[model samples]
Target: MTSTTLRGVTIDYDDLGPPAGLPVLLVHGHPFDRTLWAPQARALTGAGHRVVTPDLRGYGRSGVTPGKVLLADFADDLAALLDHLGIERAVVGGVSMGGQIAMEFQLRHPRRVRALVLSDTSAAAETDEGKRFRNRLADRLLAEGMDGYAYEVVDKMLADYNVTAMPDVAARVLEMMCATDPRGAAAALRGRAERPDYREVLAAVEAPVLIAVGADDAYTPVAEAEAIHRLVPHATLAVIEKAGHLPGAEQPERFNAALLEFLAAQV
Candidate 1:
């Protein structure tokens, strides 16, 4: 557990593995904290890669200021984090909303990213309908609270196999969502609704890109990953079976294996 001040906001992050090892930054999605990367961090560190996972402004124990947070704000916070840690560059990865932030970070600080690992995410921006839906969700969260949202999405978050066979995993995810501060979560949703399409950004990514998604991801879906893989100049794709949006926790072994293979090729 460690902390840093970025743009007047306190950012909470976990720094693992030897300082001299190859650096990799893993960002978590909305309604979740940095702890979401625990499974992957352990695996990556054990494989000799330096793993850094940080909680974005609204989530976790990081800054909880009341305001609209642009996706670029998340990117700037990441750049500030790397600068604070004296890191020149790293392999950046994220899932869902975190993946969108990763794209924003790469666009904001190109020289700081060596490679990209986009998991269960998309390259498209929020559609007008999507924005309206998200705004309604934000309003609901701010008005009613996270309980309704958490319960409603828990089943949607994981695959049917997970919801049935992996009750503990499902429960943990629910806890993470329910534990989130309503205000912060609402702010994140509002900001996310404004994220721009990254397909054009993918065309600009010259670094190695590994796009992985669950075979049964209902939200991002496999086709979204395919679209990203097709757009990135240098990209590879992996699909883990029996997993949903959060494959890192649901299918860590397969996810780690694919990620390790990619990292090995780089280092």
Candidate 2:
């Protein structure tokens, strides 16, 4: 892990892939660290693309003591990570809540994003039920503490295959979940769950966009991916069968293939 100070905040990240290849920035979802991207990063780098994954502000090794940073602030941290790495423009992708931050980053600074990918993420247009879930989740986190909250989230994150066929990966994910700061996780959830709808920006993003979802992702189902695909003029939607919300971890091979195909087309 490498550390850099940006905007008076300490940012921690990992840089991989070939030095000469185009950069691919991987942003993780709630309660996860850069390690969540290891499989995807390896596959991308093996295919000749540079990969960079960062721990979000207040998550993993990154300092969260500064307190209550917004999703836009997370995006700013991404910007700082890229700048520190001397990457001018790169492909950026994220899963779930991480996808929301990626969208905000592109909207705030389009020139910095060469390509975009969203996996199992809502359009930032929450339904009454979705809002309720967010609120209830926040309340639960405060009540049960981070460890208890993490177990619930980890259950939703992975599918049967992850538990059965990929027990090691599942264990790793649980460890990361347990490591998360409950207060920080709760704060991040509250901050981003209330973000404005990005449907308009979806239609406006000119770069090649990939909207992916696992076939069995109950959290953000394939229908949501379809909606995002329809909104983006140049977006392609891919479904990884028999996987759940965290397909990049649950079904890395399938997810990596789809991502590579989309990125290759862009190049």
Candidate 3:
């Protein structure tokens, strides 16, 4: 329920971890919200790092803008959120589309980023198949409505981990995804599906970077993680065994351990 004015948009966020601890910002991907980072946040906090999870524009309790918004706006909003919280610099991590945002944010605001984590994300432009996949899915959403969209999204992202093996965690993620504004979700994807190439930016990143992906992730495959690692000057890639696209929820123990260890090296 907490909110802050970031470039006229009221950014909604849940600030966890200890106030005195090193700040870590967690950004969730499409069709989900701040809650996606709950498990990771709790574990990071227990390890003495502050965690801040925000509901991106048009997701969860955050207000939706009238039309589609570019990912740059999301990055700007993140900067404002950090400024509002009086955090000068901190570790930033993102999953899926959120990882893209985190990458761009680090590129534009290097001084504000102490470290970077890209979880199950790629730096390449969307393939034609990717665009077609999104278009077909959008068509389905227009035809079947939010209920159908929710089912389809959950099936794609959470089925491999949350549903079959981790029902409780899956349910929590579904709750957040289903609660989102379907129109907002579609619009976010519509605008984001065409993001530019980030390889050069990735190579230019001087901050310590950690590229991670689930071994079982079918969406953003492990190859994407390797690709990112190849581009970054000294980025490290860690694979979480037996996990899916949403490693933060499916394999949080491993994800948190890798994240904490990488962050510790930065200190």
Question: Which candidate's TM-score is highest?
Answer: 1
Model 1 residue 20 CA deviation (Å) reads 0.6
Q: What pairs collide in candidate 3?
A: none
- TM-score of model 2 vs. true structure: 0.93
lDDT against the true structure, each candidate? 0.90, 0.85, 0.83
TM-score of each: 0.98, 0.93, 0.93
Show where candidate 3 strays beyond 4 Å: 139-143, 159-162
Stretches > 4 Å off in candidate 2:
65-67, 127-136, 139-143
lDDT of 1: 0.90
Of 1 and 2, the candidate ahead on TM-score is 1
The C-alpha stretches of model 1 lying farther than 4 A from their native spots are none
Per-residue lDDT of model 1, residues 1-267, tens digit only? 998888998999999999998899999998999988888999999989999999988888898856578889898999889999999999999999889999999889989999999999988888999999988988899999898888888776888678878988898898889988888888888888899888888899989999999999999999989988888999989999889999998998999999999998878
| Candidate 2 structure quality by residue, lDDT tens digits, 1-267 | 798888776778889878789799999998889999999989999989999998887789887743355778888889888888899999999999899999989878799999999999988566677667776776777678777766666657887556667789778888988887766677787677667789998889999999999998978988989999989999889999878889898888999999999999866
Cα displacement (Å) at residue 80, model 2: 1.6
